[model samples]
Target: MAGSTFVIAGQNAIRRFKPKDHIFETLATHVDQEMLNKPNDLAFDALGNLVFTCPGNSRQEPTGYICALQPDGRVTKIPEHMYFPNGLAFAPFEDALIIAETYRHRLWKGHWNASALKWEDAHPWVEVGGPIGPDGMAFDQAGNLYVAIFDQAQIKQINPQGEIREVYPLSGRRPTNCAFDLSGKHGLIVTEAERGEILSLSVDQPGFPLFRGNNGWK
Candidate 1:
């Protein structure tokens, strides 16, 4: 997984691709039936376990859930029921996982219990204003969060205190997801889904390099 690329499809499937041989392998399919109707976004834990969000029907329903895909191919649905859970990310230097509830315009945090292999102590972290939809999210080295405001053509930066610090406008394009480049140049890359293009923005703060945990694969 350290050298592979993982992708999630709208058809309710997750695939793993090997860059070396250009081989594509099915990691999970028909996962909707096993979890929820839609699998939105995913992130890997410190131990390489896949954590994903399922926002069923794109509404504020209890049908939404957070799920985990273990290394052994086992799927586990987390015990919390959410309303349209969307983008999620692991905290930069904390034992926490943050998730966005698109329909509610809020962000929630959950403590990761490594010994139990689950997330616990779930609570609301932030309440975003306006009618903008919160989608994909990423964390910076300073523990700040950058969330893509879907349908609003902007990205909002939330500090560790869960307060909106800055709102950056994207060139009139609907952004669906965002992440910091791995080049250590502190450039933020956003997906302009409406135009089928990727936009990059220069930032003063560098992002936390993902997969840097002690348990991460070398």
Candidate 2:
């Protein structure tokens, strides 16, 4: 939970739900005064700026992009021509951001410029080759990344050195996203699409604590 508001991304807009008021407020519809093609997934930087992937409708073409919502209510886009940018997360170490390009079956990890509030140098860090759908991911305290493979019916653990450490097969076919129980007792709580189920897997260590940021939604 980043900040007090529940942030949602989809339907060409980024909305926030304030539990206290029980209302959904639109944070961004059009970035830079233009309609968002299709906002897919979102995450927060070390500074709390809201970042998301927008693949639009061009799944077969390289037209996907990324955007960020500033704390002061501003939206900025990081333009790129990639297959399909699906999910993203801020690296717990090295002030980096890792993004999933689903169609290409690749993950790009890049360092960011804190002062400029932008990505500096990002390149292909690893390949999740199989069905071309690396959906959601999270990092453990031991520096392993658990990625829910969309069509592979499994979860992969990527080590800190950017290698496939292990693979945990799932009963559900299409695992979409995952997160760890804050208390580290429930292991990894994963959501799936094919069977519409929530699965939990025991692991070696607890996940790195997620940030409750006040940067973007300040």
Candidate 3:
């Protein structure tokens, strides 16, 4: 939840809803009047820019893109072209972006370019698994990245040094997404798509803090 409202990826749109509000608001639909590909997962940069992945479809070439809901209420592409871009998250200490090129089985690292509103050094950082690659991801307060390995029935924990620290086994096979609870109660929570269950695990530390939302978050 960001900025007292919940924003979610909807069909060809970014939608927002508030508690007690019966109608959901459409935040974005297109960029430069061109219809957008269906938005997949969502993220927020350190600057509080609402970011999301739009992977059109399965294709031989990388055609998916990442977009941001800017402060001006405009939809713009942060970085373009990827192979079925899936889950994404911003690093806590910097404006750097960590993305999952799911189909390519690669995890990418990039730095934000505020001037151009894009990423620099947008290249593969490491290789995880094959065809069914990493899905939704999150970072802990300690800066370690936790990635859900689809079809692998595990969440791989990789330290900042790119070293694998742990392979957290799960009951379900397909884990779609994961998040760290800001509250002191729950540590890490995951969504298992295969059996339709929500799972949680205790952690040593809480999740890294995130910018509240895109609009007037500062």
Backbone clashes, each candidate = 0, 0, 0
Q: Sorted by TM-score, highest first, which candidate order results?
A: 2, 3, 1
Tell me, by TM-score, which candidate is best. 2
lDDT of 1 at 175: 87
List pairs with backbone clashes in candidate 3: none
- Total clashes, candidate 3? 0
Winner of 2 and 3 under TM-score: 2
Taking the tens digit of each residue's C-alpha lDDT, what string does model 3 give over 116-211? 678888878868886599999999878899999888888888888777788899999999899988885878899999999999977676898655
TM-score of 2: 0.93
- Which residue ranges in model 2 land beyond 4 Å of their true spot? 1-3
Alpha-carbon local distance difference test for all models: 0.79, 0.82, 0.80
Ranking of models by lDDT: 2, 3, 1
Clashing residue pairs found in predicted model 1: none
Q: What is the lDDT for 193 in model 1?
A: 84
TM-score of each: 0.89, 0.93, 0.91
TM-score of 1: 0.89
